[model samples]
Target: MLIAQISDIHIREDGQRCCGWVDTAPFLAKAVDKLNALRPSPSAVVVTGDLVDSGSPAEYARLHALLAPLAMPYYLVVGNHDRREPLRAAFPDHAHLRSGPFVQYTIDELPVRLVVLDTNIPGQHAGELCGERLDWLERRLAEQPNRPTAIFMHHPPFKTGNIPLDRLDLSGKERLAAIVSKFRNIHGVFCGHLHRAIQARFAGTIAMTCPSTAHQVHLSLGESSIMAFDMEPPACQLHWWDGHSLVTHTAFIERFDGPFSVQTGERIEIRTDSIHGRAP
Candidate 1:
């Protein structure tokens, strides 16, 4: 089974660049186009969070228009920048988007059980996975004791090595980690919000993040600017479950016309290739 994940789109409705620089819509459109053209494509695409710069009705509409060309099923989660009310109003048809303030659901048909968690704290940059959400997760895990599961959310429970941004890390992480540690069937946790691809270990499971479609956060740890946007191409993480373990690969969207074939069953050694006797 294959799944594609895109995060932190930060779409703006005013047609102005985010922070007066990044044009998120065009990058997202290109990313959608690339995902549509993949051979033996992903079964689904998951937008982890920050789908818009602000969760306004117009922003959602712009996002919808930008992602209209995607050929696979997709879903969204709320981020700190997201407004639950406007998001629900815009995507009323979405299963996760309803009459409530929280958007949480499970995708159970695939080989790996998917648990979507709501960690958005209203009017705050920091996040919390609190009592109600923890109880919900515990019940869900108990129901499928041995199934391989993956938790998807917007804020990672652990720090991603960036000191300044780490201030906004998830609260009640100890509680969440303890619960996940008890579930041996859990495979990994996926999230967004840092605008970079990051990985950390929490309770013995892999916590992975997908890069943003708009701009990347500067890797520098020292903070001179609060936010930075670079011209990095939009990317997505492809997760494949091969019966026993889950492996992830990243792809950047680009435009070109080509027909290609893959020889998947063969292996070549790069060192051997470099020293071969093929000179004339």
Candidate 2:
């Protein structure tokens, strides 16, 4: 099974741009097109949040319109920039969002089980897993201890070297780690909010963060580094499960050079026009 992961879209109202520069809607549209054009299309797409610049009704409505063209079923997770009620109202057909007090649920139909967690703490830029949420996760994990499962949440549990972003790290990470350590069936913990692709060793498995579909957080590793974003290439992550193991690949959304014929040592001439209409 192939699963695609996109994160931190930060869609804005129709005529607005995120951070007064990034027109996120177009970027997301490109991502959707890229996903649809994949040869063996993914079974589902999981958007790991920051779905809009602001958690407003108008923004959510715009987000709904932007995401409507996805060819396959997609799941949504809550992030710091997301508001649960508005998100639920935006997509009434997504029954999973309304499953509980928090926007957390499981996808049982796939060969690899998916457990999505809600780590958004409204009105703040940080993430957390309170006692109730953690307990719920424990119950869910206990239910199928032998099933190959993956966890999805917004905030990464470990502190990334990026100093500024780490300040807003997940609040109950230790307890989370403790719980996760006991689950040998857990395959991986995937998260977003860093706006960059990152990975680290956690409990008994690997935890990874996906890149944003728009602007990316600048890679500055130091105690005095200030928070900033850059126009890095936007991309999505593809997770392929081949019955026993899960492998991941990063797929860039924008068009680039060529896939030359390696066997013939030849280069095929293709359109060099930039996707964003910029000079190459």
Candidate 3:
């Protein structure tokens, strides 16, 4: 089984560029192309969050239109930048897009049950999975104790080490960790909102943050630091489940340079000289 994860699209309704210069549409289109051409196509695509920059209806509509070319079914979660109503309204036909208010639900049809969490706290930079949501997750996790489960959420429940970003991350992380540690079924936890790909060990599971298909968060390792972005090649994450284990790989949207080859059973030589045409 295979699932592709793409995050932080930040699409705009008026078609204006997000963050002043990066046009997300083209990058998203390219990402779709990469997914489509994947050797063994993903069974589904899970967009972690930040579907649109402004929580606007038009932006959601635009996002809907942009991802139409994807060949497989796609699931979604909510992020701080997203509005619940607009998102649910935009994709009412989506299976887990609930009617009440929250977008938390599970997709159990696949080999691995996908537990989608709604961590978006209204009008807040940080995310909150209230007691209600946590209870829901606990119940779901208890249902199939042995089945492999992968968490799909917006704000990660652990510190990312980026000071400013961590400040706006998910709240009640201790409670979340306790719940996750109890559930041995959870194989991995995938998240967005950081805009950069990062990985950490949490609650006996591998928690990974997917890179954005739009832009990347400038890498700052300091515990106290400012936020910035760069034009690093946008990419997505691919998870492969071979009935025994799950492995994830990064799929870049930008076409990399030629995939050169090196022959085996041959002696290679360094041919370059320092600055001049002739050897020293």
Candidate 4:
């Protein structure tokens, strides 16, 4: 099974742009197109939060339209920038979003069981997993201890060395780590909030963050480094599960140069007409 993951879309309503210049809608549309055009199409797409620039119904509506072209099933997780009620209202057909008080659920149909966690703390830039949420996760993990599972959330429980980003790290991470350490079935913990791709060892498993489909957080590692964003190449992560283990690849959204033949130095003609637009 192939699963595509995109994060931090930060879509704004029509005629509006994120951070005064980045029109996140088009970037997401490109991402959708890229995912749809994949060779071995993904079974599902998991969007790891920041679905909009603001927690507004209008923005959610815009997001709804942008994601409509996805060829496969897609799931959403709550991030700091998303409003649970507005998101639920936007996609009433996504019953999983309304499963409980939080936007957390499980996708048991796939080879790799997906357990989505809600870590959003409304009106705040940081993320948290309260006792209730953590307990719910523990119970969920205990239910299928032998299943090959993956955890999805917005905030990463481990530090990424980016000082400013680390400051907004997930609260209750210690307890989360403790709980995750007991689960041998957990293959990976995927998160987003960082706006950049990063990985680290966590609780005997791999925890990683996906890059944004729009602006990316600048890679500045130091105690005094400030928070900032840059117009990096937008991309999505593809996780391929071949019955036993998962392999991940980063697929860029924009069309790039040629994939020339390495041995003969010949230009290989491939389709480049799909994603012609560049990220702003």
User: Each model's TM-score?
Assistant: 0.87, 0.94, 0.91, 0.94
Residue 174 local lDDT, model 1 = 92
Model 1 lDDT tens row, 28-139? 8878987887655777888988888867899988887787788988888888888778877777667566624467788888888888888898888888888888888888
* Model 1: per-residue Cα lDDT at residue 37: 73
lDDT per residue as tens, model 2, 31-67:
9999998756788999998988789999999889988
lDDT of 4 by residue, 62-147 (tens): 89999998989999998999999999999999999998889999999888899999999989999999999999999999999999
Q: Each prediction's Cα lDDT score?
A: 0.80, 0.91, 0.85, 0.90
- Tell me how far the alpha carbon of residue 140 in candidate 3 is from the true structure, in angstroms, after superposition: 0.6
- Name the candidate that leads on lDDT: 2
Q: What is the lDDT of residue 261 in candidate 4?
A: 88
Worst 10 residues of 1 by lDDT: 271-280
How do all the candidates rank in terms of lDDT, highest first? 2, 4, 3, 1
Pairs that clash in candidate 2:
none
**Could you tally the backbone clashes for each prediction?**
0, 0, 0, 0
Q: What ranges in model 1 sit over 4 Å off?
A: 99-101, 222-226, 255-280
TM-score (C-alpha) between model 1 and the true structure: 0.87
Task: Provide the global lDDT of candidate 4 against the true structure.
Answer: 0.90
